[model samples]
Target: MSSPVILEDLQEAFPGWCIWRSSAGRLWATRNGRRLSQYEIDHGLCQTIDADDVAQLAEQLREQEAAERAL
Candidate 1:
């Protein structure tokens, strides 16, 4: 199960989006009725994170999206 705090951070970082974990434990974030990011958590990797990590992920996503838009 994913941490509620992390989910909350995602919500704050991307308002009006749906953030949830699938039954298989993959984390997903969607915005404007579209999928934004999907983090696979079943790889025995990071299953949880601190607030700073959440902030970093959000920033990274923003940068990626900006770069994509620039292309």
Candidate 2:
């Protein structure tokens, strides 16, 4: 219902990631540590992940996690 509450829920849903919603309503997520490598980028991982909503954002994050594990 509030910004801080929503942020806390997002953090719980996606631990260790930095999550935020933009002024226009797009949801963004990025890892807390080092950036993705060149090989990871070439293989489709992103430096900053964004989506129209939470579900899509979760999907992208899951893919990113899987890709990183594969590397």
Candidate 3:
């Protein structure tokens, strides 16, 4: 998979942004469905991903796909 797809998959695997109704009604990542503050989401996404880690994941996925294709 490509970098974008890898990122998408990672998001899907972990907690993801969703429609939330709370003090603030909007997409949120909190378990309570409360709209997460900008700081919350920013820090959360950062904790979930590192730039180097994402690049490594993308490279691994690409190599796997290439191997599959070769078969």
Candidate 4:
């Protein structure tokens, strides 16, 4: 099986959120400081929220952070 995405990489892509993987190779993500297992990320349920969207998410997050800093 292909290796799952690293937790640190996901966390970097999604700043301010906590992302990690379980021993069972499950991916988890949290935005409100609450951990939620994102099976879709592992099972390819949502492309927009999957590994391919990492760059997009990172850009969006950067924009949000910049906006927040401007306030």
Most accurate candidate by TM-score: 2
lDDT for predicted candidate 3 compared with the true structure: 0.38
Give one digit per residue, the lDDT tens place, for model 1 in 1-71: 23234757767665645556667655655444543333332322222322234445555445444544554
List candidate 4 stretches off by more than 4 Å.
1-7, 13-15, 18-30, 33-52
Which segments of candidate 3 are over 4 A away from where they belong? 9-52
Model 2, position 38, has a per-residue lDDT of 88
In model 3, the worst 10-residue window by lDDT is 43-52
Model 1 lowest lDDT segment of ten: 42-51
Relative to the true structure, candidate 2 has a C-alpha RMSD (angstroms) of 4.7
Tens-digit lDDT track of model 4 for 6-65: 556656555666555456655544454433346533542222232234444455445545
Query: Best to worst by lDDT, what's the order?
Result: 2, 1, 4, 3
lDDT of 2 by residue, 1-71 (tens): 22223556767866768999999999999888878778889998788889888777777777888887888
Q: For model 2, which pairs clash?
A: none
lDDT of each: 0.48, 0.78, 0.38, 0.46
TM-score list, all predictions: 0.42, 0.77, 0.32, 0.39
For model 4, which pairs clash? none
As a TM-score, model 2 comes out at: 0.77
Residues 39-71, candidate 3, lDDT per residue (tens digit)? 654543221222345445445344433543554
Judged by whole-model lDDT over C-alpha atoms, candidate 4 comes out at: 0.46
Model number with the top lDDT: 2
Q: Count residue pairs with overlapping backbones in model 2.
A: 0
